[model samples]
Target: MSYRWLKWLILWIPTVVIGLWEYVRHAFLLPYVSMELGNWLAPVFVFLITLTLVRRLFAKLEAMQDSLKRQQVVKAAFEEREQLARELHDGISQSLFMLSVKLNKLDRAQSEADATKAMEGVRHTVRHVYEDVRQSISNLQNALQPADSTWLQSIHRLSSELEQAQGIAVTVDSKLYDGLLTNRQKVELLAILREALMNVQKHAGASAVTIQAEHHGALNVPVPAFSCVIEDDGKGATEEELQELGKYGIRMMRERAKAMGWKLNIGPSALGGIRIEITGGGASG
Candidate 1:
């Protein structure tokens, strides 16, 4: 039966049984049965209906709920896969296209200095593409990694990677509870953090980077919001570079923040380099 029909049947069965019993007791049994005996039998009727029909109906409803939950899990997995595909297309694919363009420039260079500049551009594009792919792979691995691996651990891993690969010092100071973020939020936030650090390694010329996250509102209550900051001590960007910051990877970070209903701000850090701030509503999901 349809769900609505099941509900209607469950609701009416008790009433119908009680009404029929009452009618029979008054119309026919009054002559043969005592009032006390009819009153005692009423509870038996209710107990039998609840034990048999109502219990079965409840079981079916529970089964349907479980099936729906399973379907939702499958749907969420598909959605995550789709998101990964989009990230690859927007990031790595674009970098590859840029790499091809740089190659064309290198091929057409007419002078030694021109060829050298073009070669540098080609190298930069190749390095950017490599970082993009490596970051994507690391993110996927983190997703499939054991649940014992916490989000903070992922952050530290990313920091460690940067420090080892680029010889830059990375420090993390996080106060926001992990329970405050959903898994999807944590993933997006991590990607954003990774992109920010890559930008530092590529262009910031910094020696040290700091990542800080702070929770807002009371500890035991619902947090209204939180903020995470990635800052570095390096040569800051010029106005022209700041204006072009939204071109590639930084644009992806902005899109990720927008998807999460968050704000991303880029500015000069007090420590001498750039600062990236991501602010969003606190989470319980």
Candidate 2:
């Protein structure tokens, strides 16, 4: 019940009880009303009023506590963003600048061997910058991973970051989101998608990638299953190559899916590259 209703009931209790008592005295129980009765009931009335005030006080305190928790979450997020900014400037920005200078030097080199050496330096710098970014993400996530973010919002952020970093076009279509999965499920799903995107950046030479996700019901199916597909238009893996030791990233992604009791499929997509599909059967928490 609402606090307001409780307050009203508490405030009226003494009057209601005393009036009923007086009515009973006149109608069936007692000979007549006594003026001293009001004095006797005064203590009970005071008690009810006191109890109402205490109830309101506790309710206000609880509301304030909730407000404080929300503010703390906001403050933590701000600090994490500030830390991320410092790392980006110190790491990624500097690396990209050096990579640009190396590319310029490669173009101006007269010897083919000199140009090849410069190109290798450029590739090494790029890899270092990517690793630096992923490490930064891990650090920041550990320190202040916001539980309130929706999966759709997380996907948008990830897709934008990959597009900017790899210069690959990314398209995302989602009809299922917030209510279809619990926070833990969303975290797992995002980890899987991020792994897939990393593979695309490192291996897929395609110009575009597409991600589709949904959670829908079917008459024959007892529960709606959460499902997502990531596909790219780059060279895909052969069935034999999929089992190679070098494909450890794919194995890790599969392990995550298996842990969640989800199916993980790796195969050719219509887009002409690889398609990764993950599906979970169960009701969302």
Q: Which stretches of candidate 2 lie over 4 Å from their true place?
A: 1-144, 218-223, 282-285
Candidate 2, after superposition: displacement of residue 138 in Å? 6.1
Angstrom error at residue 102, model 1: 4.0
Q: List the residue pairs that clash in candidate 2.
A: none
- Per-residue error for 273 in candidate 2, Å, reads 0.7
Tens digits of lDDT, candidate 2, 99-168? 9999999999999999999999999998978776885676566444575587778888778867877788
Best by TM-score: 1
Worst 10 residues of 1 by lDDT: 242-251
RMSD of 1: 6.0
Residue-level lDDT of model 1, residues 67-147, one tens digit each, is 988997796577557556755776678788988998898899999999999999988888877876776676677656554
